[model samples]
Target: ALSMPHGVRMRRIILPQALAIMLPPWGNLLIELLKGTALVSLISVADLMFQTRQINAATYLSAQAFGTALIIYYILARFLITPMMRWAERLVARRLGRA
Candidate 1:
């Protein structure tokens, strides 16, 4: 894990530095994953976006479906991933002062 024998901990080396280093490539992968989610309708997985398409087919609300899918992705990225990343950074920072 390469934890420091001195005051610099592994998380300091990893979280702010390693995570930032990996995030660009990870963001690209995340974008690709989100794009693939659009294809879920073909498999009948019924995720938010897929259900939106189902709603569109049943009703005439294509906009509603797209809007809901957009919200779902926004919530996942903003509420879920971003906060987790921020927390990880903060936690690592806090621990580094002691480590």
Candidate 2:
């Protein structure tokens, strides 16, 4: 997208809409990120799920971790995804000459 001109029709029209498509996909990405984190053993990447399991093995804070992750996803969808959707709506409107 950087290769395209800023504020020009090609970039602003195309890029923002495309990026907003990613906005909705972030729900899937968040679920995937957490699940991907769970694959530390196979992927060789140490992550939060492994840490949580280790911590639970030691101190057993299962409920807290589960609640925190839920809240995090909710906040992300609210604050992040909603804004992108709004922007996408405006872009679509502008493209239709509604704005």
Candidate 3:
């Protein structure tokens, strides 16, 4: 058997396992946080939804403004965060020899 330092063992072994277990929920949390940015706009943070609301105010196009923001958020989650999380999960599973 080979001896390994604590950090090395954790990095090479434990983290992968933990990451596999944590990734799904973490991905959900990320998407929720992304959606939560709309709420953040209530505090004057100037996020996407904030700009969407501004567009609505100026153009009086509530449906178009909010719908565009919704589409943007869905695209981000579908194309970006979801894929990234799935890739990470697959990478960790592959490393753990469980893929």
Per TM-score, the best of the predicted structures is: 3
> Tens-digit lDDT track for model 2 on 34-96?
455553344575665656667777877888876665675567566765676677667766775
Among the numbered candidates, top lDDT falls to 3
Q: Model 2, stretches more than 4 Å misplaced?
A: 1-50
In candidate 3 the C-alpha lDDT for residue 92 amounts to: 78
Worst ten in a row by lDDT for model 2 = 34-43
Q: Which residue pairs clash in candidate 3? A: none
User: All candidates' TM-scores?
Assistant: 0.54, 0.47, 0.79
Per-residue lDDT tens digits of candidate 3, residues 1-99?
Answer: 159888998888787788889989999998999888664465576688779888999999999999998998899889988999999888878888997
Q: Evaluate model 1: give its lDDT.
A: 0.65
Which structure is stronger by TM-score: 2 or 3? 3
User: What is candidate 2's TM-score against the reference?
Assistant: 0.47
Q: Count residue pairs with overlapping backbones in model 2.
A: 0
List lDDT for all candidates, in order.
0.65, 0.63, 0.85
| For model 1, the run of ten residues with the poorest summed lDDT | 90-99
Candidate 1 lDDT by residue in tens digits, 48-76: 66577789999988887888788777777
